[model samples]
Target: MKFEVTILGSNSALPTTKRFPTAQVLNVLERFFLIDCGEGTQIQMKRFRLPMSRINHVLISHMHGDHIFGLIGLLSTFALQGRKSDLHIYGHSKLEKLIRFQLELLETKLDYEIFYHTIFGTNIQTLFEDDSLIVQSFPLKHGAMPCAGFLFKEKERLRTLKSDMLSFYNIPIKNRHGIKQGDDFICDDGEVIPNDKLTKDAPKVRSYAFCTDTAYLPKIVPIIAGVDLLYHEATFLKTEEKRAKKTYHSTAEQAGKIAAEAKVKKLLIGHFSARFDDLKEHLEEAKNIFPNTALAEDGKIFSVELDRD
Candidate 1:
């Protein structure tokens, strides 16, 4: 299965000529999940060639304009394209009101149903789950705004049957499911065939965490520990630590600290402030603490895999 995260926008607060605000798309086994929809997110998506119709679930970190301003435009475009699948949006209570009011004022109706799941309070909980994957939401410290971060995890996969061994053992086709489920096969002579001889272990489950628009909070470390990939907001540099604290944002160093504390396999830092024209300092600062850190650039894609460490 293909699991990757594509950065659509990676700036913070304001959009510059080269960078847009915050938005990302996570593709797990071809299913796309969008995170944050800042202004110009649609344009970024188009530039990256990510099909809007493939994104069925949209997760919002906060109500800040830099995080959610492009939602209306994206939804409107989906409606214009005659999309009929129900779209699921998970966010705070105000998001529903904001979207519904905008559509009502424009007298525009959507062909698809919009299902809103309001995440209330500040508790870490499972937001969605299915046979293949699961998504969880945890509260983030983003000043007065009730913000959240999402964790996407792949479920345990079924073991694979060794075709050559199965043929050697003369196992019937009806017993394939039992072998995959780790059950021993009983032959006509009542001899037991070991499950390990017929099957191989499945790939390890992979997880990705999205932590943006939050301050340096250590409490989140345990919740996201040992993830395969972590995308944290580095809205400022270490030199602007005081300003970052005041605005409840994280510096590159702070983001690196979180990733190191959580023991994640790789760290992706983004949500850069527009004051700086380059990201050399951000990359250097983060790498000083976490050597596996990388800067999140627009249209960049990161693949999720089992951590060798």
Candidate 2:
């Protein structure tokens, strides 16, 4: 039961000597979510031994080159590797045309089908879901046409019957499912066994939110409130707050403000400006408000285990 996030790239627009661009890997259950593929994202995946085939879903925050430049390369590699599974991509409406243009220019035909869901509104809507997890997107103010932040939540878990309780009560093996589902078993002799005495409550659901390339907007607080983990772009330190606003990006302090207001459990900030050689200022600025903040670095992996209590 591991739910984790791996940072592949953390640089904002330009690639620095220490960082790449924007890319993150979200591992929920057994599914892989590639969020905002930037340059060299495929290489990072290979370095980390992440299975490209298993990654069928990609969520692009915006159409900026730093966020989506690596998509073409990744798709090309998938084709080269002879992938045959249908892939689904969620992003703004222009993504369909943008990707189609590249494919058309290259005259490349994918062996797999590519499904695109273009997000155009500012509502919190479920983009896709499976038995284990659900993914939703909400609009962010990135000054582009429309950029979105994504949320991934694990599905509700079922209770597991304690083996000791079952063995102590001499419960039949065939009735385990019923017990786990809170159903009491009635014996042939008319004996009743309460469900609470057999099983505990299910594990709490875990959630993660990705907010990038957005200005200091507190309106998104409600949408991502109480998320287990939050990844927000912190392109500048507090000293450069004006610059961040001019660029429609958030300062480290601003990112922390949003996380604190939203009451997120943990905050990871990335997309640092190229001017800063050291990231201590960014971390300190965020920690001043949100003590749980961590500066995002390339190749850094953060694993999140949900608290059952």
TM-score winner: 1
**C-alpha lDDT (0 to 100) for residue 293 of candidate 2:** 93
Clashes of each: 0, 0
- Encode model 1's per-residue lDDT on 1-309: one tens digit a residue: 778999989999888988899999999989999999999988999999998898999999889999999999999999999999999999999999999999999988899999999987489878889999999999999999999999999998888888999999899899899789999999889999899989888888899999988999999999899998999999999999999999999999999999999999999999999987899999999999999999899989999764322
**Could you tell me which residue pairs clash in candidate 1?**
none
Model 1 accuracy (lDDT, Cα): 0.93
For candidate 2, write residues 8-32 as lDDT tens digits.
9999999886788999989887788
Q: What C-alpha lDDT do the candidate models reach, one value each?
A: 0.93, 0.89
